[model samples]
Target chain A: MSARDTILARVRDAALARPEAATNREAQVAERMTVGPKGIIPHQGQATGPQKLRQFLEKLEANDTTVTRVSSEDEIAHAVARELRKRNLPAAIRMGEDPMFHAQDWGSLDVSRGPGRLEEPVTLSRAQFAIAETGTLVLTSGPDNPVTLTFLGETHFVVLRTEDLRSGFEDMWGDFRKRGLDPRTVNMVSGPSRSADIGQVLQLGAHGPVALHLFMVG
Target chain B: MSGHVPTSSAFKSNSQEALVNRNLQAALRGSRGNFIAKRAAARANVPEFDDIRDQARDMKNHVLANLDLYLEAYEKKVTEAGGHVHWAETAEDARRIVLDICRKSNAKTVNKGKTMISEECGINDHLAENGIKPVETDLGEYIIQLRGEIPSHIIAPAVHVTVPEIEEAFRKHHAHLPPDRDLSELASLQAEARSELRAKYFEAEVGITGANMLIAETGQSVIVTNEGNGDLSQSLPKVHIVMASLEKIVPTLEDSATLLRLLARSATGQEMSVYTTFSSGPKRSEDPDGPEEYHVVLLDNGRSNMIGTEFEEMLRCIRCGACMNHCPVYQSVGGHAYGWVYPGPMGAVLTPSLIGVEEGGQLPNASTFCGRCEAVCPMRIPLPKMMRSWREREFEKNLTPSATRYGLGVWAWAAQRPWAYRLAARIANRSLGITGKSKFSKLPLAGGWTKFRDFPAPQGGTFMDQWKAGKR
Candidate 1:
């Protein structure tokens, strides 16, 4: 065996020799109650991730969540205001001193795009996505947008293009490395913020979002 | 969560009652369900979970083996990066080092993230006693701290506490609020905490947080949390202190990534937490944000003793609270009944090492030899065997009671003479068969089993006797 295998073997041998821990093992199986996760809609055939995301946004719009296609952050600002009012959750989008976020006029939206204020929900601009095979959103922190945006809101709406959903984390990080973008913090949003902290009872919107609407536009 | 941990004398007398409390059954059932399912879901998604854990464990162990070299290298790198590294041999030294730094900076108050080492050292109590109020910035920790209670769980400190209790605590503490409102609004309570913590964050002078992993290659620290308090604690203060065990060092960023991937999934089953941050030294020259002064306090309360022993693998612990989550005893008692800061199976094994078993003895015997803890441990710390070793340590030191020694010694003496032992087992089983009826209605001996109910009587005949009779 090579040195890697040799070290691993030693560790494995050490572990197997350990005395078995005996806790209450009295179990008669119960059937697990879960519906297999709802598979995302439609097919892209041979198209890239962008095509799949475009299809996903169409699905969301079909489910009453709309999308606003944009070339710049200005349209994103407008879309966010429209979506928040539609969902009955107020918008408190904050803007920072970064030239990228501040360049957008924010279009009469109830906004504050800097450091998030306490007790108010916010929809700050996102840089990009590391979309999963499933529709998971990956947002990282840099000079433009920090880590707080993803956490502080009761409702989070990310406006990324369909083409932005790369293959997976490994694929995205590889691309990030190639671009020399030393990403410090990368956050992935699946559904909404959730917690079971109290009595194993499922309570959504524990600390963050209860409703997450993805407004993906091409 | 006790008004305070009862004095050792009081605790020794009341341990039985503490374990048999009215709420014990409820707490155990609630805790056992959550962690078991969490681990199941986590493992289901990542079938390579065990392999990932193994790689991460070895990575940590390899770093520790060359710890002196890496530590010296880290110090050099830290100084090069304009950060300060302090070595604390003892809790008092760690405290004094932090206190002196706080004093130098003219700090009146400090906002703190949950650091078990700091908790182990009772830093908050020490700081508070010296009139420097240290506020716990994490929401769960902050709530428990305000209530003047010890954390009942490692990751979720206030896990055992109900919403109503929290509501009452808030009602009493949130003095400026209207007292007669419906308390169903949890977001408002969270908002209240945020606003309260927000003021402390802005007003506090020094901030202290724990590093989940310390990257040796870059001389940096990483903390992963959803509440976003670690960042605030590190950034808002003029001086930021990262208190971490010497065991928390990883070799490289790539290694840190592998561990981070395992951590959140193993912990709360998140793909990655909302915040997985890295802070190296103080603010850079071009950077306008971050702490002006960064200090890393490397603590080894008694960890070095494990570096080259059967228990050396215990140092590979990542503090993910996975083992504790699945710990049956911890689930039953919650953390407070363990009577030390570290609770669960990991604590049962680790506490004895740090605080002399002589001071906090009997903790090692608290488990029922349940293997779930070892099964779920990412590092695969041989918790039961280590705990048994600790019990052996107690026995060797004569810390066990005289009655236990006499009884066990008599049993051993009888067992050596197989015929006599067999005869005794036959008699005992017969008697149990009579008096026990269906089961042992009342057990005369055995402290743990009898305290709740009777142990089931053994089968009527000895195995040897039954075998011989059947052969005939």
Candidate 2:
């Protein structure tokens, strides 16, 4: 027999050996997949309004992700430029063909549209959703926001509108399904990449971005 | 560098060496309280942390009971999403499957993310023997790879190596760099590794990573990592291979969410790992860049047999490393003492189950039954109970040492008879009291215990005699 069949048979046999497994397990699994029951949602995940926003900002800061709230969408380019200048990074930035970015006129910054390169000093992407529960940004892999930019940049800049922020994974996933979006990869990023491997001391910017700045638009 | 041979039978000697290895002790001391304190703070921040753990444990139990159905569902979704799933009944089968895919891709170099399943299968050795160089991208894994050693600790693979040792490894392996470059600071070392590995990321043909969870609903293999190497490894390579065990299956993304809520907090005390990527199949046709071919290798070396046995709860493990971080014995001996891919309390229960009671029996005996492992376990696996069960199996199978077996036999015989037990206890109490000192600097038949510290002398009559005399 093929390995798949043999392994499955053994698993089936072992599972059926139990008295409890004699119940209709196939139906139970099907129901679980279809119903998709949510488990105990932490009280922190149930925040709303100003409290949620406060929690989100606090979490972002706690995770070492800097954030700046811009009053309007048009101000994003300026904010990006300001951050780039403040950090002394180059005026160039790599990104994908997201219409939201294309609409904005990048005044003096070098904005290139494509996937990430081997050496990306700065890269920008628009987060589809932000979870306030853990200060996580949800980005889907596509031409709009190429996934490489999320991991290849020395410094990553993500744009998220305040309205796109959800309370937690439950709401975020709800909106994700409602949009009927099916990307090859869904990347949830909480903060800058880090590792505590060397001497068990936490250090940021292991392989991804050394610094992650959020341009939160309201 | 073939598959790691289990040295678990020599756990006593391995732990003996580990306890005196000053370098290992220093490294362990540095990392000892960090994880414990951070986990405590993370738990305190979430009022419903324990409740979520309970829910996670129940969900995993349900999944394990119906594992066959879930695997079928998960496979179907992967196939629909343009991904291939290969089932391997043994580690050798898994190695062969991974090699076939790599050979098909003509991979000369393979980049890897931190996958303990891959380690268990000895994928790197298999690839290297086949003329393919496998590069470990995770910093800790990379350090151990450089040292020609397996991972000691699961999360922190090089936790047994001191900083000076790391400097030496980097200096020896990275001879291409300037000899007198600044290697003193931690940041410099991290920067050097980043630059060194950044180039290799783009050169590999196949990228292999371990899956934290394989969602049956979406057929997406999820990876939770602090470093983004796993993402780059999968995204940049032409072929992405995910090595996960059969037990990694979860019913849906919602179930994965519940596990995720418990995973990072338990492992590293983060609310969420920096990157939690859910990758389904090959890249979408419209995507700019990603692996063109995706394969998931579901391994079941011994997990299938564990499903209906006393060790069934072992399958609920999420590889969080919390049990080890909180285990006192594990803290003292370090991970290498377990002499296997897994270590500490969870490993104590699981090693025997996976490798058999004969070869891996000594690990279950290494515990002090402190119950801290189960207390901190997000899955709440009865680790001490399972260890005790293994000890029983070992004794039954005659795998335990002769001396231990004889002692146990005497204890059992005495325990079954109230008169003999009382007589023996009274005699032992009186004999110890006859020492006339508060403690014995040396004791007969207990040299091992006395070698470390003094044995306290019995001060009074036996508990039975004291109770009879109304001393309670």
Candidate 3:
């Protein structure tokens, strides 16, 4: 027998070993796969709009991710430029072909549309959704928003709309399903890359972006 | 060289050596309350932490109860997503399957993420013996790999290596670099490691990682990392092989989310890890970057027999390392003393289950039954109870030492007869009350206890006798 058959058979045996055999195992599993049950949603992430935006900013700061709120989408480019200048980084950024990003006036900033490169000083991606519960940025992989840019950039700049901010994973996943884009990867990034491997001292920028600056288009 | 062979049978001696090893003791002391305090603060910050833990436990239990069915569904989804799943009954099977994949991919060097599953299967040594270089990407794992030692701690693999010791290892290994380079700061050390690993990540042909959660709903393997090395490891290689066991499966994305809420907080006190990447399969046809081939090796290595047995609860482990963090014995002696792939209270119960009661029995015996492990366990695994079960099994098998068994026999016999118990208790108390004076500095047949501190004498009599006398 194949290893799969052998292992599955043993699992079946073990489940049946009990006095009350696990009946309807396949049916129950099928039902669960189709109708995925929603477990307890944390009350912490139940707020909406301004209330959630405040919570989201607080949580994002707690993770060392800086956020700048812009009153309109047109200000996103200026905010990104300002952040880059403040950090003394090059005025160059890479991004994908997201129409939301293209609609902005870049104002002579060097912007490339493709995947990430090794020396990319800064890369921008529009967050599909932001979770208020943990201040996580959810980015999907595609031509419009390549996932490599999320990890490859030395300093990552993300554009999130206040309206797209979610309270928790359950709500965010619901939105994802409605959007109906099945990207290869769904990255839920919370903060700058860090490691406590050496003497348990928390050090940032251990392989991913050292700084994650969020441009919140409120 | 091969992987470190199991020295679990000599755990007694190993712990004894660990207690006095100055460097190990210093490292343990430095990190003693860090995890405990962080977990406490994280728990306090979340109002619904316990509720989430409960939901997570229920989800895991539900999946385990119907593992066969879920595995089937998971396989179907993975196949639909253009991925392959290989089933391995033992460590050898896993190693063979992985080797076959690497050979097919023509891999010379493979970058690795931190995966306890690979350690359990001894994948690194197997790959090396077969002429493939396995580069550990996680900083802690890399440090320990350089030292040629098993991880002293799970999450913090090089926790036992002091800062100076790390410097020594780096200097000795990276001799090609400038010898006089300033390695004084932790920042400098991190930069060096980052630069070294960045080059290797791009050069590797295959990247192997361990899955934190396997979602049967979408055929996705989720990995949670703070360092982001797991992402690079999987993303850069031509073939990405996820080393996971059958029990890592969760029913849906929602189920994974519930567990994720508990995971980072319980392990590292983070609201969420920096990177929680969910990779379903290889890159899409239009994707700019990602691996082309995706394979998941589903290892069973004795987990199958654990189902429906008393020890089945061990399968719920998510490899969070929280149990070891909160384990008092572990904090004192450290992880290497457990003498195997796993250590601490979780290891105490799990080691025996995975590798029989003979070689791994001493691990369960090492526990103090403080119940701290179970208290801090996110999945609510009753660790102390299972350790007690192992002790019982050891006794039934006559694997327990004769002295302990005889002593327990005497105590049990005396307790069964109230009159005899009281008579003996009174005699012992009177003798100790008179001879001990304030406390017994020395005692027959208890040098182990008296060597560290004096044993306090009984005040008057046993608690039962005192209670009866007070009533009268």
Candidate 4:
């Protein structure tokens, strides 16, 4: 027999040996997958409106992620340039074919559109949704937001509109499914990459961006 | 290192050596309270932490009872999403499956994310023996790999290596760099490793990572990591192979959130890990970059047998490492003393189950039964109860040491008769009282107990005698 069959048979035998096994487990599993029961949502995950946005900003700061709220979409390029100048990073930035990015006119910043290369100093991507409870950004993989730019850049800049922010994982995922989006990967980033592997001291930027800045647009 | 021989039978000696090893003790002491304090602070911030843990435990129990159905469902979803699922009944089978994928991909170098399942399967050794270089991308795993050692701790693999030892390993292995460079500060060492490994990330043909959860609803394998290496390892390689146990499956995305809520908080005291990547399959045709082929290897190396047994609750573990972090016995002896891939309270119950009671029987005796592990376990697994069960099984199988069996036999014999038990206790108490010393630095039959510290001498008479006298 194939390994899969043998293993499944063993699991089935053990499961059926129990006295409670009289119930139809197959039906139970199917129902669970279809119904998708929402478990206990923390009180903090249920906040809304300006309170949720405030909570998200507080969480972002707590996790060491810098955030700048721009009053309009046109101001994002200027915000990005200011952050780069503040950090003394290169003036160049790599991004994808997102139309939001295309709409903005980068004034003096060296902006290029493509997938991330080996030595990308700065990269930008648009997050589809943001979770207020944990300050997580949900980015799906596609030409609009290439996944490599998320991990390859020395410093990463993410753009998320205030309207796109959800209270928690449940609402964020709810909005994600409503959009009928199916990307290869769903990257939920809370903060910049970090590691405490060396001497158990936490250090930022381990194989990913050292600094992660958010351009929150209204 | 292709196949690690189990030294668990010699756990007594291994722990003895670990207690006095200066370098190991320094490393263990340095990291002793760090995880505990962090988890405490994280739990303090979450008012509903314990409530969520209960929910997480129940969700896993539901999945376990219907594991066969869930596995089938998860398999179908993966196949539909243009991914392959391979089931391995044993570790050898898992190794063969992973190697076959690497060979087909013509992989010369394979980058690995931090996956304890890969460590359990000994994937790195198998790959190297077949001439495929496997690079560990996690900072901790990379340091241990450089020293040619298996992970001492699951989350912190190099928890047993001191800073100087790491510098020495880097200098010896990375001989290409100038030998005279200053390596005094911690940041400099981290910067050096970062630059060295950044180049290797783009060189691998296959990337292997372990999954924290496998959502049966969406056919996604999720990896929760603080470092983004797991993401880069999978995204940059041409083929991505996820090594996960069958027990990693959850019924839906919401169920995964329940586990996620507790996982990072329990492990490292973070509200959320830096990155939690939920990957479904290979890259979409319209995508700019990602692995072209994705495979999930479902390994059931002894987990299938764990069901319907006394150790079934162990399968509920999310690999959070909290049970070990809060374990006093584990804190003192460190992870290596357990003499296997897993350590501490969980390993005490799991080792014998996976490797058999004869070879791994000694581990259950290493615990003090303080109940701290059970108290902090996010799954609320009865770890101490399971260890007691293992001890019973060991005694029944005659795997226990002869001296321990003889001692237990004597205690049981006297306890069965009240008169003999009282008489023996009185005699022993009188003899100890007659010593006139407050404590004994040496004893006739208790050299093991007295070897470490002095044994206090009994005062006056036995408890039975004292109770009768008080009544008079």
lDDT of all the models against the reference? 0.66, 0.92, 0.89, 0.91
Q: Rank the candidates by lDDT, best first.
A: 2, 4, 3, 1
- State which docking tier applies to candidate 1: incorrect
Per-residue alpha-carbon lDDT of candidate 2 for residues B1-472, written as tens digits (9 for 90 to 100): 5688999999999999988899999999999899999999998999898889899999999889989999999999999999999999999999999999999999999999999999999999999998999999999999999999999888888888888999999999999999999999999999999999999999999999999999998899999999899999999999999999999998878788899999999999999999999998999999999999999999999999999888999999999999999999999999888989999998888888778888899999888888999999999999999999998888888888799889988999999999999999999899889868899888889999999999998878998899999996
In order, the B-chain TM-scores come to 0.93, 0.98, 0.97, 0.97
Best by the lDDT measure: 2
Q: TM-score for every candidate vs. truth?
A: 0.82, 0.98, 0.97, 0.98
Relative to the real complex, the DockQ score for model 4 comes to: 0.80
Model 1: runs farther than 4 Å from truth? Answer: A1-74, A87-92, A97-99, A102-105, A109-120, A128-143, A146-218, B1-15, B185-188, B285-288, B434-436, B446-448, B457-459
What would the C-alpha RMSD of candidate 4 be, to one decimal place? 1.5
Per-residue lDDT tens digits of candidate 4, residues B235-332?
A: 99999999999999998888888888899999999999999999998999999899999999999999999999989999999888998898888888
Computed on C-alpha atoms, the DockQ of candidate 3 is 0.75
Candidate 2, residue A68: the lDDT equals 87
User: What ranking emerges by DockQ with the best candidate at the front?
Assistant: 2, 4, 3, 1
Q: Count the clashes in each prediction.
A: 16, 0, 0, 0
Q: Give a tens-digit lDDT track for model 1, residues B137-192.
A: 77778878878877767778878766666777878988887788666766566666
